[model samples]
Target chain A: MTTATQVEKEFILNMGPQHPSTHGVLRVILKLDGERVVKAIPEIGYLHTGIEKTMEDKLYYKAIPCTDRMDYLAPMSNNLGFSLTVEKLMDIEVPEKVKWARVILAELTRLNSHLFWLGTHALDLGAMSMLLYALRERESIVDIYEACGGQRMMTSYIRIGGLAKDLPADFDKKVRHVLKLLPEKIKEYETLLNSNQIFINRTRGVAVISAEDAINLSLSGPMLRGCGIRHDLRKANPYSGYENFDFEIPIGKNGDAYDRYLLRVEEMKQSLSIIQQGIDGMPEGPYRAHVPGVVLPPKEDVLYKMEAMIFHFKIITEGFKSPFGAVYQAIESPKGEIGFYISSDGTNKPNRVRVRPPSFLNLQSLSKLVEGSLVSDVVCAIGSIDIVLGEVDR
Target chain B: MEHNLNEIEEKILDFLEDKFSGSIISRDKFRGDWSFFIKPNDITLFCKGFLNNYELDIKYLSDMTSVDWFDHEEEKKGRFEVVYNFYSLKNKIRFFLKARLPAENPEIDSITNYFASADWMEREIFDLMGIKFKGHPDLRKILTPDDLEGHPLRRDYPLTWEQPVFTWNKDDPPEVIK
Candidate 1:
């Protein structure tokens, strides 16, 4: 054999467009010298569905359902962003009840997304039982989605003008049940992972980035906050009545995977507080806005009244026209800042609909995260980012 | 209450007018948000100006995308418009910068040198919208296969167009789905 100094040590390794740890179809090309990664180039687009192009062809309100399919984990957050952008473009002020109800739904979605992330991330790090525990808690949230939107994952319940329909009869009871149960389960998860030796070894100081680099890379959500940057859009720029609620934005000291894990766990508690505030301070008003010929009328009214029936026929046949302008609206989605930029040409269909996906931005920092770490740390870093490939390749 | 411009708006207008007055094509406020249309040549400098300025520290590049304004009714600058959305974390304000490029060879200087986040966003605009980003180091297609024919997001590209599949058995007829 040749001497160690004269040998060719560097080699190429392809880590997946199909691996389960990637969370979706994300392929990373790694240049390795022994076990240390010299350079990691991420190759995406295996899940490309051309969603932005498809959205341009559909009517304004009809495109709401398409948003659900992108970030399938937190569909309500996507729906909220798209609807807020279109509502701003059209200059429609939804009722007070709608805002409070939306806050409730959006916060619930944050809990749902974070739970799934915690489960899958822990499982990736060899904590096998966390997956079962986390998913068991997730089922209750899925039940709420089905009770409200009739679909578990693709719940396009939050419509343009307002919600798809009023809250279900037992919506209050079901939400209250989740609210009471999750706080204890969250504490239990902390007890399991906080003291575990394997998790701390893999996560702490694994992928560290400073606050300045995090901002320079344009990271958001927990990614930015984990770097000790206090940048939550809900507090920085409030929307959908998020200003009225009171909650803490948990931040991390070090920009490593372990800090991110702790920050997200604290965020679950904060989400619960926001949900509690929403349920306590909910106001009474119309479920949907009263913009005739634009917003869909109530089913009972459409069946009985002539004007409601005529308006329904018009809205179904040809969607209402929007003003000629553009608007950019962003929300503090569970992943990060998911925004929608819509340009209308005074037509029923939007001129351009561009989604500023949070996962796409967060995924860009992978090369930096796994710069000189071992190949196994790549899995830890990717799981930490919590990327949904559907949104990344959209 | 809505008639008066906010403090941040006044300050941004004053700064832009003071620093780079001649480059601005038009500035408008729609639904309480401000957007500026500037010349393509001045985009890199304008981004530099925003980043270097102490008061208007608009460091974060939220998004960069293009709109194909084909057969539009409203008055616009050119055939293709590249929009950049920037947010100032310090000032807590948003600034929208836009530049127009011709349809034949739409091109603009990439701001990746100024902001590292501009790398992937610029590549995406190149890959999907077919607008070239000059000086982007690795401008390969991000979301599409390498052998694809044309940009899918262009308005001229048919929505339902499908790519022909390659097969080993060239003698067999290609299967078609209506």
Candidate 2:
């Protein structure tokens, strides 16, 4: 007969409700097996602002600004996704010029997001010098965003029927300057990490998820493509005139943290190609659609013309109604396919709006990857996953 | 990419045949999005068959959420309606499964075993809606603190949070945020 052994010596550790490493108000309950993670449970919601429920009451047009703060890094992507869904339901079309400009700006937004990811991902892996170099270039992208839309981060420039306004005259010059400089900067990052034995050893085989497992986990964007799934939403189901642009989807043969990093670097190159194409073959037409009720008139026209003033006032105070239907529009954001699932019941306010954010989905596989791995490698795996807790917790 | 939604509905009904008696499910297809209602008890079985037997292969559980039934309070329509969003990697289609549960006691089977992604998602729904998930390996408040009292996202719950909004433009006037 064998007596039962008591395991009362174990202790639970509270990692964070506010630790810098936990990444954005994320709390993790860590049950330790002497310095090893026995069970890692992520606790969130310290930043739950109830934005989804808040969207239920606000008018559809008012909700555009709300989506920006959800994933602050990829605000334009969120704006584009939401606007595309609204346009799909309304069945309204913007001018060819507006469409192309949207594509260009959205791609630029992708650059901003990817640069931040690169800097932060490397910084998390203890490459602090790389972060400063990456952010130096990232500041220029933010300057472009501000110059084009008059605001940084929360642009809210991508409207339902069209853009908030036309692209600035200097937009092309600025984009071209960044385009010329970005390749060299990217190569600098690659040279620092690509051949470095330490970085390669920490990331090359760490958090290696197979292609089938990545698909099962519903990981999208570079994470899925890094695993060789070749599932780029932009290439597969293009929206916002992405089908018209020409660009290659870079896929990694190895499914690891290093592959994900390489895939993102290659994707930035592809994004530059698409933007250049969009600008070169850009069509000439009006910037905004002809839907007066749905979209706001230009500021000049609103101030000068009586008709434009009334239209703008009505839209600002009492939003327009959308047709009774819903559409799920997913765009290939830098992190992954950022999808907007919108439902309207023929009201000024939306009946339902659910964001299928890819970061949230990609973060699902953390346990699957980190379970058996060394505790020290958890940060590298998380950085490789490239999750934005703002979007994830949202 | 396109199929007769009515025919699909008929097929589903015929497939599930009177096993769930008087389960007159109302399915509404808006645009291309498909949504069907199911009883709380039958949701687990229906979802199982919907994924496996029907070749939907919606192995990816995208998201799970819930809404309070306060608008339908007069109809005594219980309390909450849990919504599930699934994307079938095989067919490239998405489906919305809604289960209406009693407000008095909202309970449903755990789909985590079927879709591992549902592990955290179900916890989120439970944290926000207070809907209990039976057989969930470790169901707890996901997006909220463990010591938190109520589900703060309910209709009755106020959105007037205590956090202050930071503004870079000092000239900007303060707006009353409801």
Candidate 3:
């Protein structure tokens, strides 16, 4: 009955499915009233490839590549999670050397992922130079991936029983080269943003989530740690011989966007230290376990030995069978806790393969973080969560 | 921690037996992680109990997913199973709870009240597996388009490729590539 000017109007704003800041093809629907968001609903699955359904059709060993595409940034961690789950079900144990190498590769993967997040998040917040500098450091890590796995990005190096192959002869030297350079590179990144007024002003007190709310929302990795919860699966659960390596779980007190930034920076340093320790304490043994039917034989053995050739042929034609059971294995991927739940019906192919992708869980907290903040801060809030749409849509 | 994990599992089993009584169908352990199957009717009650239990304090809902068992022989009771993965941050232990739902009307009480994280997960299940979550505030398709016809994750849903509506060349009439 009143005039139109007297009534307050709220409108729905669609943020993305194509916008650069939303990370991938993530579309966020926002109910706004004059620059203030009333409700934010994230519409996902634009990149959905039905990887879970596809995995069920693939053999246990063949499914590793599909995991790589989920969290494309941290492919090795995905590989480690899938492999460990399968290894647990098969009751196969890799040697100590395999464990050490796997840890190194996984940490490198973490560093690679964090670097990408830092660059992209900075770019989202208008810090253009940070992207170039971050990518410069990431190049060396990509080289390491390429050297070992023959692919830069989707290196499914970590296999079911062990590694795809033993570490290259110069793997130590190449890793040491990157490790030596990372500290200085990280320092440069910190110097760029740590005390910068614009960076601090834009990030501090923005997208704040409390410790209780974080746990209730099932946030993980730096998202939970930024809320002052010192929980890292690498430390708490200790899969892939993480117990052997000594590294502190970085925690943040402010539980804001800036705090998440600080936590990821600290995690990069810790990952470097873990990589250093792994190289120093390298164990000497076979790279893969001695599960003949399940794990592929060495290339040399396959070429000469008849038994090895037969085993290889058998495995290539018909993949190894797992018992009828279900197992969940979680690893501390750079994004968060990447868990795999596999149910096998004593067949070459899995009955069901469910990935508990960290990005999917972490992205849920975005609404809570951005609800009360200015609509302009939405990009910062989303970038701080560091969600890879590959993982989210999977 | 090792001793505490065992104690936690035992306490959880005891609590379920004492509280739910006849609801629990079976229990099993996989790679040191405990999993329990509960009757569909008591899922919400059991989840509430577990989440609110003083000692257990299963505060985090890590994942909420469903599995279609249309092709499996062992799943005699139902055609679909809803799986809930819970983690206790205080105790640093994880346990999985599963409930069976018939294929006809796969619906369960939503746990969004207990864990806000369950909102999106429940929606994802609904979108992909065609499982409905009762009491969900905004139940809608999450990943898939709203107009998508059938749940893709169901066993009965064929994985065959869909034919494109447009053809690469107009002169050749149309080659509906599937």
Candidate 4:
């Protein structure tokens, strides 16, 4: 019998299921060759909650709340995507005010999502101050969320018919106040991150993916846009009256982390433009459409009026039946083209509900980008992709 | 009679009269959608022919997924169906190709040879729906785990194995809700 060799040739590196910096239960099994990742085998499902099957059992209306769990960073966008699919299947028309409200809130949510991305992403790279500063700016949007929906993080505010309820009387003022302060705060962030030498050296050419490769990998949102793909679902395929709004699509030439960073900085400015237009050209109408039977009557209306009370009772108990059909609705979420495919069987419960989450696709490109790069470069690659595991694992 | 969407459907139907039948597909100017039910073996040929030979140029494979129709109530021969959504990004035309495959033996030709984007997508289908990608190079799990047994997206799969917390009015079980 031969004695076992004293020296070990290979060592296994176990990444997080509970580590804070892994962002979310993303356990990556890295085969190491002396600080170099030879083969990266990602082990997922620690955060697997089986969201898809639950949607199959939940009714079309009941499924909206579940969406809040998908991309917890941008719950509003997921809510919008799911709601849009239900609306398409039901073939219910939304009011102008509702569209504007969706755009504004969705944009605010985009800002919220990006702030979290920038914070956590910068935090991963040891930019401790950026995380604090970014979170400080993001708190305004969280406050706005709390004031409107009585929840800060997962606000199931955007309902299928139009909204959970009409925008509170203080909605307009709170939104405008935040909008006014955002431009200055954004400039402050740009000044800090745009010219920082350490940040520049770390991100400039790291994790470069060309436009063609980005498309082939099916990357979307900022990752795709960062690769000079002048495509945004809001622009390419308009939903929620995005056509009426005027905004520019900022493209990147280098298709690197720096380019992505630059593009997002510009995007924040463009988002500001879109929000201003939405508020300026804000239409006045019934927040929800005239689909009385489909939309739940207001609490006050239900409590006061007998007709409203009866409709509310029926809607709450039996649930409004949607048209029997399948429809796929996609929206330009902060991440990318978040698509919702819903199948209705002429019943209260949905036959099927599927979310084509962007982070999942964006994360798919990780292997391609990480295949040859250094292990340290992996952090930048992860940051550049800006994936939320909530959406990815969902 | 001109080249309306219905006319196109009728034209395709007339061309492939040997394969399809019924009013399930018609040109009613209805939903304004084009759907093609293709044979599992014919998907590659159809996609290539639809793009190159037929000048359909369906260059963009927008999404490809497999669905478990276990709770479908149809009791049909097949328990699952694979859906491929194609888009001609140039012409702005969209076509949906669907194929039914038995859940017991879910195997189909991988479309990665035609559209490179289908590589990860097919792997995802295999990972989530347990559809065996016959010709895929890497047919392992993309989003889940290596040792994970059941595909979680299937209708039969439970949402979560964790038990619920007992409320004030509800009866409390002895076991911990883990």
The per-candidate count of clashes, in order, stands at 0, 1, 0, 1
What's the ranking of the predictions by lDDT, best on top? 1, 3, 2, 4
- Candidate 4 chain A, poorest ten consecutive residues by summed lDDT: A1-10
CAPRI quality band, candidate 3: acceptable
lDDT of 4 by residue, B41-85 (tens): 777766565445354334666777766777666328477778777
The C-alpha stretches of model 4 lying farther than 4 A from their native spots are A1-12, A31-36, B1-32, B47-57, B71-77, B91-93, B116-120, B141-151, B156-178
lDDT of 1 by residue, A1-394 (tens): 5676456687677788789899988888888889998888887888888999899999888898899999999999999999999889888899999999999999999999999999999999999999999999999999999999999999999998999998898898999999999999999999999989999999999988888888889999999999898889998888999889889999999999999999999999999999999988889988899889888997778999999999999998899998888899999999999999998888899988999999999999999999899999999999999899999988
Cα-based lDDT at residue A26, candidate 1 = 86
- Which whole-number lDDT from 0 to 100 does residue A360 have in model 4? 76
Writing each residue's lDDT as its tens digit, candidate 3 over B50-145 gives: 777878777888877788888678668788889999888777888888898987888888988888888889988999899999999878777775
**Candidate 3's C-alpha lDDT?**
0.87
- Model 2 TM-score on chain A: 0.94
- C-alpha RMSD in Å of predicted model 3 compared with the true structure: 4.9
Please, what is the TM-score per model? 0.96, 0.87, 0.95, 0.87
Best by DockQ: 1
Candidate 4 lDDT at A394 equals 80
TM-score of 3: 0.95
Docking class of 1: acceptable
> Per-residue lDDT for B1-178 in model 1, tens only?
2223377778988998888898998898887788998999899888889878887778899888888888884435578889999888876778788888987888899889998998888888898889998888788777877667798888888899989735312232112100
**Which sections of candidate 1 miss by over 4 Å?**
A3-5, B1-5, B74-76, B165-178
Model 3's i-RMS, to one decimal, reads 6.5
Model 1 RMSD in angstroms: 4.6
Which wins on DockQ, candidate 2 or candidate 3?
3
- Per-residue alpha-carbon lDDT of model 4 for A1-394, expressed as tens digits? 1233324444556666676766887765666566766666555555656677788777667777789898899989998898887777777889899999999999999888888888887788778888898898888888888877789988989887788877878887877887888889888888888888988888988888887677666677788888877778887668899999999999898888889888887888888788889988889987766677777776778889998988878877778887655567778888887887665656788766767778777776766666556777777877888878888778
Off by over 4 Å in 3: A1-8, B163-178
